[model samples]
Target: MLRLIMLATAGLLLGGCLQEEPAFPNVDLHGRLVVDQEVTGARQAQGIQGEYYKRVLSVNGQDMAFNDFVRHYCPDSNTRNETCIKAFRIKKIDDVSGATRFLPNGL
Candidate 1:
């Protein structure tokens, strides 16, 4: 029957869709910055100095090198004029030992 064939096709399509893996893994490594930012100047700079953006409410991915994590998430801008993104939690992957460490901010 046409109806039976359509149902089978629909079932196969749904099954295939369901079997697809997520593009980004759902994970919160619960990590924070290891070092604190140094504040020396204006209100804008001071605003960024406080031990904020160190909370591990959410994280992006699973495996990442420490240096890579720093380069990606660490705030290096001194101007502080432009609207910048607050750092997110990063689970740094150790290069030497291949160890996973979650550095929680002791704010």
Candidate 2:
């Protein structure tokens, strides 16, 4: 009799666990479409290496297109690369002169 009671209790516990209920709510009855712009080019770079990166920048919760900010700051297209680097908060020049910064072959 005691063994039968134990078996019955275990069966009840296992059965309860096996039953599945919806844990999360499905509020969206209508199908929703999500859209996002694809990211291209280098995400981060410093100085001249960052030239022609063509990447969007985000700063202090504000998003600015790469070329837009670069043109606004530098104005001169020739210095766009340098301006873009500075705008994105990437260090343009190494504080210590004569010291090599980036590795060879864009490593």
Candidate 3:
């Protein structure tokens, strides 16, 4: 009898844990950025360009905003150094239109 009761409780708990469907439908969006870093020499009053972040594989598979993705995943430091993360795949999410795209990086 105790085993039966335990089983029933477990089933109920599992059922409650199930997540509800999102009100806003999700979709994927894909794009790329030609990243370049420019530095201003205060003394020289001239701008020097550093090695630009290239071929940044961008995808919206997890449905994160552009800015959010940059902050959470592709931080500015990462862009500058490319050492924050060697490789990552993001689920693209469009804020205004509500679209989704998954562009996993091969690198």
Candidate 4:
């Protein structure tokens, strides 16, 4: 009887675990953005016209606009510096509008 009770308890626990929702439901939106340092005056004098940086939003390797990424992920833009490395995990993407809904994970 004790063995049967233990088995039932274990089964109940496992069932609960199985039914629980994932931390990021439906889609696992995880990616990194690597922003490079600003070009110095000397570099610009040598004909560097614009900022040199790499922006990547790897939503299953799908490409996203830099502006959209910044708007959604980088809320506190004032604190941003030349060099930045940020990791982001969004909650879900709108199926129809393609809008990104992010989790409360801070920058």
Candidate 5:
């Protein structure tokens, strides 16, 4: 019985680790979409090399990471599609620095 309990506990812990992160709600988010370039030396050393582009949502000056946006608005789909774009109510696109910024409607 003790062995079974230990096995069950371990299984639960592993299951939790394998689960996907919680997604944000699909509410109207007012923000600017910006591209954040992420480079990891560790990943490159492991033979995975490339510039990873993360879509950051800057709302009221606060930045939300790509995972949250993709999980909420475009799960299992590309983040640059019309659905994701329309959700933010894009106003203007500007090339600032190395990031592509999309201004939200209104401001």
Candidate 6:
């Protein structure tokens, strides 16, 4: 008798798990359009690689695509690679010697 009860309980549990869930009303009836985007050459260079993100910014009460004030270069202290490095690392040139305080390459 106990074995029969266990089998019945297990059957009920498995049966409940197998049922499909009902979708919400009007979900598919209303939403229909789908858009797929593919990244291009310039966007590929800027988006996953470029240091900063492009966004709609307010400049002088006008909206424009302006590059942020940033410098991208590989620091000498780190292993040089294709990855663009973002740093506040300032390049100061000696007024007298006319030589940079450090190696600064910004692109």
| Model 2, residue 102: C-alpha shift (Å) | 13
Candidate 3 lDDT for residue 52: 29
Q: What TM-score, over all chains together, does every model reach? A: 0.28, 0.24, 0.28, 0.23, 0.30, 0.21
Better of 5 and 6 by lDDT: 5
Candidate 5, clashing residue pairs? none
Candidate 4 clashes: the total is 0
On residues 1-107, what C-alpha lDDT tens digit does candidate 1 reach at each position? Answer: 99999999999999888633223333333343342223223424757343322223233655553444445444454423121112222322233222234434531
- Residue 98 of candidate 3: its Cα lDDT? 26
- Best-first order by TM-score: 5, 1, 3, 2, 4, 6
Ranking, lDDT, top scorer first: 5, 4, 3, 1, 2, 6
The C-alpha stretches of model 4 lying farther than 4 A from their native spots are 15-50, 58-107
Name the better of 2 and 6 by lDDT.
2
Clashing pairs in 6: none
lDDT of 4 by residue, 9-94 (tens): 99999988863221321222343434335433445679866544344454335676444554554445443322122322221222
Off by over 4 Å in 3: 15-30, 34-47, 50-107
Model 1: pairs clashing at backbone N, Cα or C within 3 Å: 32-103
lDDT of 3 by residue, 1-107 (tens): 99999999999999999854323222222445443233123322455333322223344445343454445544444343232233223322222222233334642
Candidate 1 regions with alpha-carbon error over 4 angstroms: 16-28, 36-107
- Number of the top-ranking candidate, with lDDT as the measure: 5
Model 1 C-alpha RMSD to native = 13.8
lDDT of each: 0.39, 0.37, 0.40, 0.43, 0.49, 0.32
1-107: candidate 2 lDDT, tens digit per residue? 99999999999999888734223222211112221122212322322232222234453345654344445554543443433334333223222221122423321
Q: Superposing every Cα of model 3 onto the true structure, what RMSD results?
A: 11.6
- Better structure of 4 and 5 per TM-score: 5
